[model samples]
Target: MKFCLALLSLFFAVVVADHGDHSDYVVKTGEDLARYRDQCVAKLSIPADLVEKYKKWEYPDDEKSRCYLKCVLESFGLFDDAKGFDVHKVHHQLGGGDVDHSNELHGKIENCAKEGDAAGEDACTRAYRGALCFFKENLALVKQNVASK
Candidate 1:
């Protein structure tokens, strides 16, 4: 899935704060992200075929994939049902804690959240939608960041 591929490209060197015990997940390198991905895959019981497809950047629009994105986002302290998305957390992580860059990233993230807003949908669906929008909006920057890493 384009969305999944782009979303995965967003991670770099950042440690998520403790959101009730989610402190253990610190995504400083690709290895840490892979560890969390494995955990989410096992926790959700995602199929081997699906995992393989995802690795190839082919995401299926299904519950498992959507929930997988949600799990990843939550692990990064980027999203939740109650808070929707922690824009500040994401800005800090992706913006490298740069206050001067805050407004630009913050506005982009806010717009994406609005684009993906679905009050009637489930949390996983909402998270997936928002992530899709977020990545699509920031694809170039994400690619640059990924290349740097």
Candidate 2:
């Protein structure tokens, strides 16, 4: 009986750890972005070619690429039709709850999104636009984080 109870406890612990909230997967640096990209690709079943295109920030020219962007954006909690982009969620995820840093990044992203021609675009177009804007705006940070890692 004790052995069975111990096994049950172990199982519960594993379950809880694996199914924790998205907060557990904060993206504070380039390494974190890479990991998030990997997770998104795996979870969304994005094709290798599409993944490559995404890495280059190329606009999605095919359905698979578009779907890949959609999956990635949704996973990052940066997607919203009515609100355009969830800057706060993105800031929290990438800044690791650093309000000042997140706010600064958020402002950059907001400006980029506004300047981009995402209005009236299709789902894929919008996702690609938003992603392009984000990557472009944070290229320096991405490079710095990746280099440090």
Among these predicted structures, which one has the highest TM-score?
Answer: 1
TM-score of each: 0.70, 0.56
- For candidate 2, what's the RMSD? 10.6
Q: Candidate 1 — which residues are off by over 4 angstroms? A: 1-28, 143-149
Q: Summarize candidate 1's per-residue lDDT along 54-104 as a digit string, tens digits.
A: 665456789999999889778767788876876666655555444343477
lDDT of each: 0.69, 0.64
Q: Give the clash count for model 1.
A: 2
Per-residue error for 101 in candidate 2, Å, reads 7.5
User: Which digits, one per residue and each the tens of the lDDT, describe model 2 over residues 1-149?
Assistant: 99999999999998786445433545555565677789878877887887786777675567676657666666556665555656555555545554563356778867766644466877666776666677777866644544564
Q: What TM-score would candidate 1 get against the native?
A: 0.70
Which regions of candidate 2 fall more than 4 Å away from where they truly are? 1-45, 55-60, 101-104, 115-117, 143-149
lDDT of 2: 0.64
